[model samples]
Target: MSDNVSDGVSSFADLGLGPELLNALSGLGYEEPTPIQREAIPPLLEGRDLIGQAATGTGKTAAFALPLLQGLSSDEGRTGPAALILVPTRELAVQVSQAFHRYGRGLGVRVVPIYGGQPIGWQMKALERGVDVVVATPGRALDHIGRGTLRPQEIKAVVLDEADEMLDMGFAEDIEEILRETPDDRRTVLFSATLPPRIKGLTGRYLRDPVQIQIGREEAPPGEAPLVRQNAYVVARAHKPAALGRLLDVEAPTAAIVFCRTREEVDQLTETLNGRGYRAEALHGGMSQDQRDRVMGRLRGGTAELLIATDVAARGLDVEQLTHVVNYNVPSAPESYVHRIGRVGRAGREGVAITLAEPREHRMLKTIERVTKQRITVEKVPTVADLRARRLELTRAALQESLMEDDLSRFLAVVEPLTEEFDVMEVALAAVKMAYESSGAAADEEEIPQIAPKAADREGRDRRGAGARRDRRGGTPAQGMTRLFIGLGRSAAVRPQDLVGAIAGESKLSGRDIGAIEIADRFSLVEVPESAAEQVIKALRRTTIKGRKPTIRRERDTTGRRPR
Candidate 1:
């Protein structure tokens, strides 16, 4: 059973949720509690602290969020924060805030995300106007404390999300300082993937008689579908998008999610995928709830087969027959890699988890492998020939199934006439080929322009040891293409330096040759000589800086305007 499934699932109503929220969860398409939620919510609603060992996309936000929202509603007189959620990055902060906003829409609640890289004045104003909940990254929350624009004295509940991550990023002191600033009586919830000494130490110092929820491997399964095959492909970053496209061509999932690290990447990859002929959607923090819903609806109904999203945006998503989960970029943390892969390989069904790592990222990949204790086998992205072979296999399987189940007597007359003009075996082969190629060429294929890999790890092996060899052996020179406006923008809080550094370090270019830099709070525009655009893009797959590996392409005209 997938850990996502609640044990014998309980009704949300039975969980003792108020009517408004019960209706909201149902309307939002949530049917039951995930394991963490079932165990965590009741105590949290009663105002107890919690320490959750959960991963992203496991529905842990709602486990804490529901009770937090409920407690706030029960105390309508409190103008100050009733709950505070601490996340690791600006992307997560926004995503958590949005979840609260959606669930509390009827409560007239205010949930604001406070993070750095955005104007502090805006956050200061939001805090002053008053908020019931504040979802903030630690550094910015600490910044607010130093600036004296926020008060934690009235805070009743404080939840630490991805706690292990905050500590790993060296925020233990800051987290401690923030916790100390809050009222001593406040309910403290600490959620971490692993209870390292740091987490245990912090929990001892902070939480008082809290509930401990551990999600183990023998974890219960939920009401999840059963046909998806789960496997992970380890490839270098530069080839991720192309690798993903190749995988799509190979598996041809009716619906799948290719998880990226940012909204900008979501948009950029969505465009790349659409150009490749798949109906793709982009889901991320910048999109409104209505937009998110519509995207989900399309995916569930099969109107869109590919969904490109950041890990934050794609949370709590459940789509039927979701055949693949491609990590267009490897996650920054090991836990994130688990969560991304966990999305696919649910229930006893098979699923695929594909990670595009750069050469330098081999260490991170190894780290993820060590933590999960799961091998992510390195494999070449399927060349066109492999795709053809896989397609032919599918074609053969379909034909065999049809022969076993469907009556073919009616088609014998047609076959008899065709055999009159050609050898009977040749006629049968031709008919089969025509039927199979309807899905496009699945046999006897040629080489494709191989995307380059970021070869940082193979220091002494054959120059063709990994990403480099893949690039040298496969890719043709790309020309006549100017850098394109990739949808991954500043709204996800991306920066020019992050982009430049990523492109330079990942690709053939030294940091000096990359051109102009433009950044918006939502998006960014970078300039590179038109000739090397594709290779530069290929190189960026290996550059995993800023914890976000996004797509780089030619800029669109609408985004060319600079923010004054």
Candidate 2:
């Protein structure tokens, strides 16, 4: 039994919350309930189970945490936690626990975070002292359950935060086992950024008579900037590094995350950005837990301005100062793009989502736009002129600030000597030039070739059409390249973008490097450099194309001849 409720309430008091919780919210400066909070808190306070479909920054934590706090009881006989919240990562577990502490301060709710990468004995000591709430990762929670350190019989409410992420991380069985240990009548709540089929299945099996609430991006009133300003730049593959640096110069983000497809890309891009005078840190599965913690610490402490990470490594991370999300390449899936962008534009703060797309990936940008239903404004890569002008503007701003706030008496001696030798205006100009040069002037700028919008669309059409004809007649492969036959084609709803996205996303090649693509009714043929043919074949074999692993091999000669 599930119901979808839609209504609006103006304030926390309007939602029937107690004074302690309401005061805590007010102290935290929470102005009003976000849509998810307004929709979820009432039913949750009434002790109804819920399924909340909201992104990371939409106040979902408080939506669930507030209700749990409202229902807190002081039953001395209860030996186990009154509520259990399961999160996907240790970082999120700590964050959720902190939220609970902040909201439940007046109520004296004892909350402890249990997760791996921390000594189990410390967590055991906390549990032994008794707690009202336990926030943990699924694996650690199960370990406690197995050791009898965690007693679930008294839990009145259970929360599976980021439920979809847990499933993706292979925690389904553990979640189920932990839930089975809890009382069946407990209030079960599930929150996810996405409601995939697996999540739906988990909900059906666990949550009872849940109230389903779905919240999308908030709509800013007409004539206002949207929460996230999405923009994409189409440029040639060779010039992407320069284009990205130029755009960053113009945007001047306080903190940003550049998402890459693989660990290698993350590492390489991190190095490149750092060399270009940006404070960057790389995060991927290849890093140890300690290394990851240090990187995160640096970012949170405002020491690192940029994080270059793969999708998997960046999931469930919420950074307070993140003002921009950069897609090093367009994500292969629209869902991924949504998740990546959702990290910013949080709590009414404006954020930006920028993408650097090669001309060949222009179509993927359109596909993403259509799916997310948000227009990605296609703009020219910032020119070298734009970069220089932005740098100068920054320098002027810095000088203006120093003039207004700094003690300039010490520099007066040098300026007085210069003014005596030259005109005042010329001395001033010389001083400005020195300041600007010291402030990291642009080095050896070059103009990046720009793509006309219509030209890119035409290029896509031309390549798809010509490649299909070339493959049908067994035409010679492009210079230094060979064609590989893929089993699924137009009939499988495969498009040129799909083939290109799969190859570029799964393998080391960029979309621009993947040559002509030919899609027939039953199969497809794509051209790759002769040297990369075997590598692409193995990479494709290991991954799925159009949700199926198609037969991938070199296209035969017109005479049905085999390779020597």
Best by TM-score: 2
Model 1: lDDT equals: 0.68
Give the candidate number with the greatest lDDT: 2
The CA lDDT of each predicted structure is 0.68, 0.81
RMSD of 2: 20.8
Model 1 C-alpha RMSD to native: 18.9
All models, RMSD in angstroms: 18.9, 20.8
Compute the lDDT of residue 299 as modeled in candidate 2: 90
> Which stretches in model 1 have alpha-carbon errors above 4 Å?
1-9, 117-119, 168-170, 216-229, 232-245, 253-323, 327-336, 342-351, 355-386, 389-564
Write candidate 2's Cα lDDT for 441-559 as tens digits.
74737888888776655554444423222221124566677878777765676756678778887889965466656555466668887899889989999999778988777765446
lDDT of 2 at 20: 95
- Relative to the true structure, candidate 1 reaches a TM of 0.55
